[model samples]
Target: MHELSIATSIVDIAWEQARQQGGGRVTGVTLRIGRLSCVHEDALRSSFDLVTEGTPLAGASLAVIEVPVRIWCGPCNAEFELPGIQRFACPACGHLSGDIRAGRELDLESIQIAPDQIAADTPEAKQPEPS
Candidate 1:
């Protein structure tokens, strides 16, 4: 349900980029999703498919780059990626760290456009602006 809104927002951004690029056909979208971001990949993919229906982004493939949670170890003085989201302790020194280095991202990384293809999907489909 929340993924649906996120998908809608992604499409909106893609549309704006497409329009800026002279309305090229969007073929694919890449998203960087973190483990701690609380976004289900399967649900997001399904929502993307639904939101893209009959729009300029219809048939666009969605690719997700899964990022693992990483934290900075102060005692060890290094950053390590956790094997899972179970604990936030340092692997080497066993020190607990509240300094998070990464793994809280939900960003639309890139968009692929096909210039050879004409923009023709649904007749009345206009790219909606992001609210």
Candidate 2:
């Protein structure tokens, strides 16, 4: 599945970010998933677990925040959550419109890590040889 590839990319990005500041094991990753992103959360989590094995993010947790599909309705003069993908009409006035406001985000919000944790995970000799 593409989840594996997506997970791989996420890990790659997190790993690079962690490694940049000397080196640190990622503890968690926060992602914003949109309602229309069409990504399966369960599959993504499973793929993340499998892909993170043996990597810097091995024990990291994946936190996914669900985003709702919203549209701006001229009839109502406001934005409202869509009941479903197909119904793009104003809830109050029943006016059909396609003024989409949000719900297409697939982003990595942040990554958490501990410096000491990274040092502990690193090989001893690879570390500085006691000055």
Candidate 3:
């Protein structure tokens, strides 16, 4: 499954980030996965566990934020969440729209390491000054 490769990449990224800090135990990882991303949650979770074995992120928890497909309805002049992917149609005006506003993301939101928090796309946390 492609999930394995995905998990591998996640591990690699988290590992590099963690290693940059202090190689501490990673507590959790947050990801934003969209419905249109075609990533199986169960498989990704399982693959994460398997890939993290014997690694620094061995016990890191994998959390996913499921994002629904949002389409921009031109006639309605608004964005609506598509209930189903069978067709991209506006719920209110019933107009077909191919303008996808969101829900095609597969991004690593944050990394929760030991005590310090590494916020999204931010640089490394500052280390404490020696006494």
Candidate 4:
């Protein structure tokens, strides 16, 4: 599925961000997906889980925010959300707006990361036994 590819890309982005920030574990990722973006949220989540396996984001979760379709009417000089996906006409003036202001967004909003923790096997993590 294409979601797998999208998931992989998301992991790549998160990994790059984490690396740039000096190496940390990703906790969550927030995405803004428009209704017209044609992405299946459930499938994307499942794909993300599958693609993150054995990666730094293995335990990371995805939060998807659905964005509604918004349009700008030229005749009425007004901006509003479409009543339905198929209806591109403005609700206020009933004018067909060819100017799409929003929606069709597939963007990564934010990424949540936890500070890197020292591994138990690391020398810095070893503790001396009490005398």
Candidate 5:
């Protein structure tokens, strides 16, 4: 399934970010998935678990934030969220809108890592010497 590939990509990103921040094991990952993104949350979670095995994100929790589909109605000159995916009509003017403003996002928002895994010599952990 494509979800497997998506999960693999997420794991890769999280691992890279964690390492770049100083070689830490990810504890959690937050993703913003839009309704129009067509990504099933359950399937993605399952795939994440499978893909992260033996990796830095092995026991990391995956958190998904659902984003509603928003569209811009040319006739109404207004932006509103779609009540359902099937209906692309403007709620205020009842006119069909093809101008999608949002709801197609599949972004990795943030990642949490274990504190102990971070390098102590990093700039954030460094102490100033006496002048």
Candidate 6:
């Protein structure tokens, strides 16, 4: 799936950053996804998980931020959110314009990394090591 490829790209970028930084493991990744970007959030997340398997980014959380679709209406001389994909026309004047303001972005916002003890889940202590 394309999500697998997208996820692989994210990990590759994150790995590069980690390498440049000299250390530190990735704990989580934040993504800014636009509605018009056509990137499936669920699929992307799942792909990321699959690609991160056995890598430094393993167990990392993928957080997605939703961005709304905004367009500039030349007829109304105002910017507003598009009601839907089919309704790109201005709500007030009912005219269409090619001035698309936003809703076409796919960027990585930030990456959070923890030192050695990154957030990890483990089984019970098993009654301790017994000194």
Per model, how many backbone clashes are there? 0, 0, 0, 0, 0, 0
Per-residue CA lDDT of model 4 for 1-131, tens digit only, reads: 88889889999999999899998878788899998888999999999999998887876778888899999988888789985789889999888877888889989999977777833233322223234
| Candidate 6 lDDT tens digits, 10-117 | 899988887777667887888888888889998998889889989988878788888888888876779988877676787778787668888887888888766654
TM-score per model over all chains: 0.87, 0.82, 0.84, 0.86, 0.87, 0.82
Q: Candidate 6: TM-score? A: 0.82
Residue 110 C-alpha lDDT in model 6: 87
What's the ranking of the predictions by TM-score, best on top? 1, 5, 4, 3, 2, 6
Put down candidate 2 lDDT per residue, 78-117, tens digits, no spaces.
9988888878888878888888887888889999877865
| Cα RMSD for candidates in order | 6.8, 8.1, 8.6, 8.6, 8.3, 7.3
Span of ten consecutive residues with least summed lDDT in model 4:
120-129
Task: Provide the overall lDDT of each model, using Cα atoms, as 2-decimal numbers.
Answer: 0.86, 0.83, 0.85, 0.84, 0.85, 0.78
Tens digit of lDDT per residue, candidate 5, span 1-131? 89999999999898899879877668789999999999999999999999998876776778888999999988778899998999999999899888999999999999988765353344333223224
Clashing pairs in 4: none
lDDT of 3 by residue, 23-61 (tens): 666768889999999999999999999999987677678
Q: How close is candidate 2 to the true structure, as a TM-score?
A: 0.82
- Candidate 3 to truth, TM: 0.84
In model 5, the Cα lDDT at residue 5 comes to 97
